[model samples]
Target: MTVWDRPEPPARPVPLDRERIVAAAVALADEGGLEAVSLRKVAARLEAGPMRLYGYIAVKEELLDLMVDEVYAEILPEERAGDWRAALGGLAHRTRRAALRHPWLADLLGGRPALGPNGLAVTEATLAALDGLADVDTVMRAVETVSAYFTGAIRREVAELRAERVSGLSKREWQRASGPHVTAMLATGRFPALARAVHDGADGDPEVSFTTGLDWVLDAVATRLTRASP
Candidate 1:
């Protein structure tokens, strides 16, 4: 009766593969977001009953883990082009795009649940992107710092996006939500600095803040790498 509705399976059992099952779940998550993904829903999408899915994916949590890794697989496992700065910058932007595309991906990936093959490959690519750093310690430190910045930035953007979707309000509206409380306090002029800050519209762009932070972090690493004698 519907476009996405699959035909009911025949009475006989249909063979199920774990990979195929996971793929279906991933597609469901991509289309409907995480909450719409469930054993029953995945089965329905695959044109089978809920009971049919468990033969491959034991539980919903397991299904989620698979779905999360599946998205991770989208990133290629190779060195990014150009020098370290451009390489790592590309890595950060690509990561943010991946998380935004999948929506549920940032939280699950950041939590570092078991790294499926795809997850390992992506991490390795990120590490390789740090080429030219002198020692193992420096390399590892750079990897962790860039990764922390990239993932943290992705998470914040995801939250902001969700807020924008639900409230139909831009970031300015979000700031305005605190406006009344801020205004009443300013009536007494007790906090001159705070008042001046608010009046100046000094909130600044979060996107630029993330980029600047990433650059500063890399700068510190470069400093350490340079200071250490070969």
Candidate 2:
């Protein structure tokens, strides 16, 4: 048969689409954390060639941006229900949990808040979450402060995880390893308060340590924001 006369094959559906490729990358991250989410690994998981993934994600950083935003989508915003304290506090907790659950997310928030759909959604949700909280400037400051604080806390926690990953140390073991530093600092009179804090804080519940500081910040901000509002 002539080439033109041969039966035309059905058009092949598009593969390696952005959404599917991004989704596969996200799944790889979720299953094995950020370290396991390389493009090659994701392609392997999707049964596609690594080059195919490049059609969707330009580079690993873009993939990370996509992943970061995807995880941000998981953070449900807190609503203003006549209790600003409850609202902001809940927002802080939710964002913190999202960062902890997907630890790489904490790293992303360190950079500027991107303007992608998921990133914009998070920014909008956060702003919307602060509805009627006084003037826009105050609201902006409050949101910025909360965002910075939560990101810092999550970063610290993730740093601990990364540090321990090398030695495979348990929480107690980490503290033990750092005990000499604490003792040395306490032995010096320069940081009495910090030494006391570390000594006292060690016995506290990990959740309490993570959640309370943000609550305190939000509490102060909410009160100040309410006072500043007309």
Candidate 3:
């Protein structure tokens, strides 16, 4: 056929890269949790052969790591004008908000080392906030301590959100009346303090609860830094 008569070469398929692959994987996970994401599925999403993804990611775990780092891009905060406490607290709040937006992230947070470029940037930001506050070892511990607190707190908050969704009950309502079992256990008086706290304590807003606890943790870190300083 003459060049003019030839069907325009079928449009070349869009090239697949790690970014597109990770994006497809993340969309799949967002729609259906981590279990929903597979290389084959990602490849299918991209309209490419499953093997096409292997060059970019050999296994699902690597894809998950990439997905986690992808979300970290959202978790990274804008510049702040306050001290280290404000910086770290801002980071923690951003992270919590990110996890809430992407609930699947709760499953992977702290499950493995975050060594990706974005992940390292997040770590660097956290450490940089406290860089001159104390010596290297103390600062490292402080970062770890704060990290551990928020990681566990975010996981629990996400868990509660899931549970609430399933039960169609707010956390306080769920605790007070999910079943007679909780009430019966508390009524037994074997856990008087627990019962009293449950009955007397106000179940305040979740964000407030999170912020208060984070402030407490930041305070502890501040104390450590002060003591460690010359």
Candidate 4:
């Protein structure tokens, strides 16, 4: 058959790009966690052959990096009219919320340097907040410290949430009555401080705990900035 005479070559599949591919992978991760995301699965979701994905992403790790940067777009914050503390704290809270929405994010947080556009924007905004407050080294150290704090805290919180889903118990419940073994251990008087805190400590809201800890860290940052100031 001639070129125009036979079905017009059946049309091309919908154009595939990195955005669509990353989106499909993110959707799969949202539904079934990170393990569910793979190049083949993403290609399947796009209704394209797996090999077709290579043009956009070279490997699964590259796709994962793109996925992380994509989520960083959600964590990006608007310009706030406040001090550095407000700026940094807002970024931390937004990041925590984003991780909660995309639980798989906890696994990837801090696993690699975020060098993509959105990720760099986040780092830029963070550094910009304290730009004039301290020397370059001090500022770098402050950012690293704050980033470390939130990264670890968010990971732990996500882990606890997963544990709760699996065990059908809240954190407070698990700590206060974590089976007979925990109860027996606590009763042994060798762990007086631990037992007292577990029994008497209130199960404060997680957000509140996160906020409080962030504030403490930010306060420390503020002190360092003050010291570094003229």
Clash count for each candidate, listed in order shown = 0, 0, 0, 0
Q: What overall lDDT goes with each candidate model?
A: 0.72, 0.72, 0.81, 0.85
Question: How do the residues 1-230 of candidate 3 rate in per-residue lDDT, one tens digit apiece?
Answer: 22112232222376877777888988998888888989999989999988767666766787888899899999776664267787788888888999888899999987666877778788887888787888999988987787788889999988888888888998678766755896888988899999888789887787899899999998888888999996
Give the per-residue lDDT of model 1 (tens digit) for 1-230.
Answer: 22112243334455566667888887887776788789998788777878977656666877787776677666553555666666667767677778878888876755653466676776666666665557777777776777788888888888898889889998888778978988999978899988888898557676688788888877886787677526
Highest TM-score model number: 4
lDDT of 4 by residue, 1-230 (tens): 21112231222476777777889999999988999999899988999988877766776888888899999999887775277887788889999999999999999987777878899898888888788888999989988889899999999999989999999988778866766887798988999998888779887898999999999999898899899985
| Candidate 3 root-mean-square deviation in Å | 7.7
Candidate 1 achieves a global lDDT of: 0.72
What is candidate 2's lDDT per residue for 1-230, written digit by digit as tens?
32112333232243555566678877777666778888899889878777766655667877787777677677756444355565556666777788777776766776866656766766676677667768888888887788788778888887777778878997789889989987887898899888778767557665788788887887788688869988
Which of candidates 3 and 4 is the stronger one according to lDDT?
4
**Candidate 2 residue spans exceeding 4 A from truth:** 1-14, 31-35, 78-83, 177-202
Residue 136, candidate 1: C-alpha displacement in angstroms? 2.0
- The alpha-carbon deviation from the true structure for residue 17 of candidate 4, after best TM-score superposition, in angstroms, is 1.0
